[model samples]
Target: MSFQQLVECATHGQTRASYVCHHLLQSGQDGSMRPVNWVRDEDEHVNAWCDECEEYLQSHGAEWNDKTEAFAKIRMICENCFETLKATNPTKELT
Candidate 1:
């Protein structure tokens, strides 16, 4: 699908912008990326860390870190793109 179509789908659908420490084009484990839905207050501050990060955070008493940088690195993607990435990274699952 075209980029325009992807944007439209992502915007029109409930798909929200998400952030990942690594590039979305790369493969990652399940729940590595976290979706940010502005429409939902609960989703705004929701922790989006992967299992490893979460564990580390819990261990270090730093469960909540500044997400500003991570948010800035986020690139909006549509369901199609999301699905494509999922297929590409068979071992990873989108949260």
Candidate 2:
């Protein structure tokens, strides 16, 4: 998807511009949602994550696996939320 479309998806169609990461849906320290850096290898595309999420994704998987390509757009998350998700989904894998 184009960058514009990704922005729209992140803001729920709002015109406000922001970056968003595909993994966890939360704003960064700046209090604005932004797209995470992406690492693409051939057909495999993965969204970068914060330190905690990075460990989780690395332990599990890093490939983009959202059912809807639109939702596949990435966003950042706070450290607290990262720990929460990691604790809640101990066995969850991003595939």
Candidate 3:
């Protein structure tokens, strides 16, 4: 399964460009959704996350953190999602 497949399955075929963009933005791909001073932070670096990260965050009850302003701007995700997917389905790498 590729990322698109996984997205389709999760979204029940409601996948759209905006949805992809939203997820990508949420996942912090290419630092597209960074804060004003996000790049200035010494520890701030946008790293690409796998499909596991995307799905896992939703499954693990990881909510947005408005206080830190990182969840929305930084595209934070749940690490547990990646761990679970990797442990359960190593081959699929989701589409």
What clash count goes with each model?
0, 11, 8
Write down the TM-score of every candidate.
Answer: 0.35, 0.28, 0.20
Segments in model 2 whose C-alpha atoms lie over 4 Å from true places: 1-3, 6-48, 67-95
Tens-digit lDDT track for model 2 on 21-84?
Answer: 4444544233543333334323232334444445444555653455233344544333334333
lDDT of 2 at 89: 32
* Highest TM-score scorer: 1
Q: On TM-score, who's better, 2 or 3?
A: 2
TM-score winner between candidates 1 and 2: 1
User: Candidate 1 or 3, higher TM-score?
Assistant: 1
Worst 10 residues of 2 by lDDT: 2-11
For model 1, the run of ten residues with the poorest summed lDDT: 38-47
| 1 or 2, greater by lDDT | 1
Relative to the true structure, candidate 1 reaches a TM of 0.35
Model 3 residue 21 distance off true place after TM-score fit, in angstroms: 20
